[model samples]
Target: MLVMLTGAFGNLGMATAEALVRAGHDVRALDLDTKISRARAAELQRTAARAGINLDVRFGDIRDATYVRHAVLACDAVIHHAAILPPTTEHSPELARAINVGGTECVLRALEELRTPGRLIFPSSVSVHGPRLHERPPVTAATPTRGTDEYTRGKIACEEMIRASRVPWVITRVGVSPDPGASSVTLDTLRMLFRISPKNRIEYVHRDDVARAMAAAVTCDQALGKTLMLGGGKGCRITHYDLIQTLFDALGLGRVPFDAFGDESYYTDWMDTDEAQRLLNFQSGRFEDYQAELAARMRPIRLGLRPGRRALRWGFLSLVRPR
Candidate 1:
């Protein structure tokens, strides 16, 4: 299979590309011509080459119908992962809509114009279900979409567009994926996580698992025209407080007291991956795996920062006022 993967250099995109290569599929990779993409594409190309995989890499805007058409040419499946993510999406609605929603339109249009009956595998965020505090135990495909914020609204718009198209499609509503190897995080990201109540349930899925699910969906006959819920299963279901505390402890930063956290619910919640697992078989990671990965990634840095533990603890404490 030849898979067209949009945003082929992002955290999830890169992982998906690798997964596709490992699954014996040729990939047509497309992304914006940016410094970041330039940096990652080489790494991906090298990996693919070593694996003896055919990776057709292209750098172009997805919003351009011509560029998207060229990228989609002869691809058997399209895994559309390109989108202006949150923080940026929240601050810039026009840019977000253009890339997130508009780009998706171009992909769909390209497919329609070419009349390809290839499978469309879109990774939709679980946030589209809005704040899932007390209403549901494990969110499923049947859950109502709540476009409570700009990001979720854009995702909902794209999902709707995909559904209305004639393409064979599957939308995998993915749980939260925090990159353990990330060296740094933005203040905006911290603020968003802080807003989530300590009581809210969060399903943390490994990025590799997400990549595997999307890649596996390409050939999944039963997954065509379906919406699957994916997460790390029961072990990954945890509270926001636990999520934050685990990171703090792993990185040598002191934990924030529970009272200092917010009380309002957030979008993240446990997902019922039974249906998706039955079809895709991608839930192979546990929360403990995530924890160990994070610890290993931060070990050297944590050792260097150990001397400033008190200062870091005090600084984190001062920043933890509940929203």
Candidate 2:
């Protein structure tokens, strides 16, 4: 299959592209012509060369209807993973809507023009469930969507559009799938972490697992017209406090301070991914694996910062909580 993947240079997109190529599918990877995108594209090319994978990378924005149409027409399947995430979405809601909702509309229109439209594998988010008020039943594909923020709302809108479209589609409401290699315990990240409630339940899925689910969606007949919740399975479910503590421990930063955490609920929650796992068979990664990967990446920095742990904590607290 010739697959056209939007946001092809993104963490999930790149992983999915690699998975597809390894599965004997030709990939037409598309993303913006930004510096980050270009760097990722180059890295992908080098990686593909070593792996003997076929990848045709294109640089363009998803909002370009003509370019999107051309790309869609040339491919047998579409994996839509392009979207502005939080902080960015919160900062620029209009741009988020333009790229997320408008871009999806462009793809759907392009598909509508085709005599034999290809399947669209849309990656939605668990944020569509919005802020959980109380502990309830595990969220499933059947759960009603009530997205609170712009990013999650955009995802919900895109999912609705896909559901109403004539194109064959599979919607995967993915949980938090952070790239272990891309994470750093920076001040900004620390500030964001401090805002999250300690008691909030969060499920994490590895990017590789997400890639596998995306690849399976391309040819799995059982996935068509279904909304699957993609999670990291039993081993990946953890409270926010546990997740932060694990990261702190991995970085040799000891225990996270209790005062740093907020009481407000976060937008993430545990998901029921049994149906998705049964259909796509993509849940193989564990949180322990991710923690190990993060630990390995942070080992050098951990060594450098171990002596200044107390000073670093004090500085971070002073900045996060003035006076």
Candidate 3:
């Protein structure tokens, strides 16, 4: 199979690309012409060579219909992971819509024009369910989508467009994916942690697990035309307070003061992924595995930051008061 993976340099996209190659499929890795993408492309080439796999790296915007059409041609499937996520999406609504919504349209059009339309594996977000009250049930594919943010709204629109199209589609609503390699104990991260309500539930899915899900969905005939909820299973589900404290302890930082944290306003909750797991067989990671990875990465900086941990916490609190 020859697969086109947009945002191939991104955390999820890179994982998916590697997984596809490992599964004996060639990948057309497409992304924007940026410095990061260029650097990652070189790394991807090295990695692919080491694995004895074929990888074609292409650079262009997803919003460009001509580029998208060219990329979509001759591909057996497409795994779309390109999007402007929040915080960034919140600040640039128009750009988010152009990329997330319009970009998807371009892909669908390209696929429609093909004599043999290929399957589309769209990685949507659980955020489309909107902010859930604490007592709400675990979200399923049947949950109503009520996204107030531009990013979530764009995702909803994209999902609808795919469903309405003639193409075979698999929509997987994913949970939070924190890159373990990028995890660090920073002031800004601490501030964000302080703001999250300790009681709110969050599902943390590993990137590799998410990649496996995408790869599985690509070939799984049963997954066609299905909207699945992809999560990390029971071992990855936890409350915000538990997640923070685990990270803090792993990094040699003490537990966060309960009084200092505020109620979370952002959308996040545990998902019912039983059906998805049965169909795709992609759950292979646990939250503890992620914490261990994070701890390993933090070892080098732990000693240097240990002495200033208290100061860092106080500084973060002073910079942003919890709501």
State which candidate has the highest lDDT: 1
TM-score, predicted candidate 3 vs. hidden true structure = 0.94
Clashing pairs in 3: 197-264
- The per-model lDDT (C-alpha) reads 0.88, 0.86, 0.87
State, as a TM-score between 0 and 1, how close model 1 is to the true structure: 0.96
Order of quality (lDDT): 1, 3, 2
lDDT of 1 by residue, 131-172 (tens): 878776788898899998889999999899999999889999
Compare the candidates by TM-score and give the number of the best one: 1
Model 3: runs farther than 4 Å from truth? 183-193
Give the winner by lDDT: 1 or 2: 1
Model 1: number of backbone collisions: 0
- Candidate 2 TM-score versus the reference: 0.94
**Residue 315 error for model 1, in Å?**
2.0
lDDT-superior candidate, 1 or 3? 1
Runs in model 2 with CA error above 4 Å? 46-53, 183-189, 321-323
What local lDDT score does residue 96 receive in model 2, on the 0 to 100 scale?
89
Better of 1 and 2 by TM-score: 1
